[model samples]
Target: MTLLSSCTRAARISAAVIALLACGSVLLQIGLNLLGGEPLAEALWRMSRFFTILTNLIIAATFAVVAGGRSVAPRWLLAMTAAIAGVGIVYHALLSHLLVQVGAEIIANHGVHTVVPILSVIWFAMFAPVDGLRWRDTWTVVIWPVLYCVYILARGSVTGMYPYPFIDANTLSPVQMAINIAGLTLFFLALGLLLVGMLRLRGRKSAN
Candidate 1:
């Protein structure tokens, strides 16, 4: 097989592994929740939840990149994934006090050590081609947010836990919730565009 095809296969394989890991982690979280019987149950639950969230976030990006990144170029994906990750870092690092409390504790209780995002970092390097970045790569990173938001909404309604306070449509008016969602989506989209632009430039250079 050609190098490109091999890389694509590897990426899809990684995504499959990641999806399994993420989904399994969810079951593990449920177990931990049930195990609240143990003294360290909360901590375990938190750790499981953290890992689950982190992996799902990163793996979703991987799927997005793997499925779409090839349409353009590898470098475009690499650059965009990096940018998307940066946006995530900024969002988590600089969240407002209200946003954090608004249900943030639920997600925070999960093991949020430096390791959570580590799983995702590899996707950008391993899956994204070293050659060129493209507009499509940006769209791949977005899969995480879009899918995750839906998961959170559904799970929250079932579990009585909103991952973040801002997302709690239960208390907030639908308008307020919509506003928050729209605002956050825009921010993520902007980040994706920037990443794509950066990758596209990199691709242009490699060809010369």
Candidate 2:
């Protein structure tokens, strides 16, 4: 088999393994939380609050990249996945340190935030279908992050809980929260464009 095909197989298998690990970590945390007397619904809701969890789900779906052999996965989906992974990495590096975790929480936190993101970027480097990406689809990448911000903000407004400090509407003024959100939105847009450019450039080099 060609090197490209081998990398494709490797990426698929790696993605599946990472996905299973992520799911297992999440389940372990949930089980632990319940055993500690946390209410079932609240435990689930808290799990969903982390961008880490959502990004890992996107990484899981990327196994679809390998489903049809040489056929490419949807470009928009790949873009969103890469963007979220980027965001997750940034969160883990800079923000997650503010919170404390122990035992299973530590394992679950790193599994989804660190391990999954590293594996995803490696998969993109080794096997992502760059040829299927288009510059025009750059705007599509922000959709998921935008929706997530909205959902979290609205939920936090009602529940008096915010996942991240920067976007905490309860503490920050509207203008400050908007500024933070806008900054993050811009970050997502720039990251998406960067990924598109990198992939397109790699595609050109591969063609030659």
Candidate 3:
């Protein structure tokens, strides 16, 4: 097989394995934390408050793209996964102290936010299909995050608990929170374009 094809196959296998490991780490941590405290289902519901968990789910979905091939998964799903992974990495690096926990939590935290992001980026660079992606599609990347923001804010409104400090309307005014959300949306857009650019460059290089 050609070198690119070989690399693509390797990337696919690696993506699937990394995703599985990340999921396992997360589940193990949750099980450990809730061992004597709450039901597994309740613990999982609480854990879903963190965007890191959601991003891991996105990463897990990307595994389908890699394993099942381009025809099986849409390009938008790949773009969304990469966008969230980039956000997860940056957020964890900067705001880890706020979300810090002990023992199994540490493993789950880094597995999803740190390790998964890095490997997902590598997988996308090496294997994500880019032939049909366009700059115009970058806006679609903002849709998921926007909807998530709405959900969290609405949930926080009722529960009086925000997942992240930045999104905590109790501490920050609506205007301030809006600014933060706008900044994050812009960041996602930029990263989405970057991924698209990288994929296009690789596609061109492979074509040549």
Candidate 4:
């Protein structure tokens, strides 16, 4: 096969693997929640509160399409790469010490937060298309996270349950919660810019 064809095949295979890993990890987490006596509806709702779960679900869907030999918009793929990068970085830096897990929970946790993120970023860097990315596309990265912050805050006002400690309404003053959300939004923006920069650098190299 030509090198381009080889890369395309490799990208599709990688996408398939990532899709399976993400989907399986999410299903495993849900099953564990159900087995632990959480009602199915409640379990799913609780999972939706987490950025890790949502981002992984996005990864699963995006990559599944690529694996199916369909083209995804480059901007959407770029946004997803930024979001998942945030999930992994934030989890390791701020949230990793807060959790204790064993057995299947451990697998699910690492699969979504660590394994999927690492693989997704690698796939993007090595194989995913970057020819259409632009600096303005960085804005798209924060759209989902900003909406999620609004959602969790709105839902927490009624339910009094926040998914992450940083955003907990009961525990944090409004000012502090706002600061945390602002910081996270900035982080996502930074990640998005960094990816765009990488694309520009690659483009320059290819032009020479």
Per-residue lDDT of 127 in model 3: 63
Per residue, candidate 3 scores C-alpha lDDT tens digits across 101-147 of 87777777677777777777777677666565667767777777778
lDDT for residue 162 in candidate 1, whole number 0-100: 71
Local lDDT at 97 for model 4: 93
lDDT of 2: 0.70
Per-residue alpha-carbon lDDT of model 2 for 116-136, expressed as tens digits? 667666666656666666788
Ranked by lDDT, top first: 4, 3, 2, 1
Q: Per-residue alpha-carbon lDDT of model 4 for 37-140, expressed as tens digits?
A: 99999999888989899989999999998888877877788889999999999999999999999999999999999999999888887775556777987899
On lDDT, the candidate that comes out on top is 4
Q: Between 1 and 4, whose TM-score is larger?
A: 4
Candidate 2: regions farther than 4 A off: 1-7, 64-72
- Model 3, residue pairs in steric clash: none
Q: Model 1 compared with the native: what TM-score?
A: 0.52
Q: What is the per-residue lDDT of model 1 for residues 161-204, given as tens digits with 9 covering 90 to 100?
A: 77566688578888898887777666667766755565455556
Which residue pairs collide in model 2, if any? none
Q: How would the candidate models be sorted by TM-score, starting from the highest? A: 4, 3, 2, 1
**Candidate 1 weakest ten by summed lDDT:** 108-117
In order, the Cα lDDT scores of the candidates are 0.52, 0.70, 0.71, 0.87
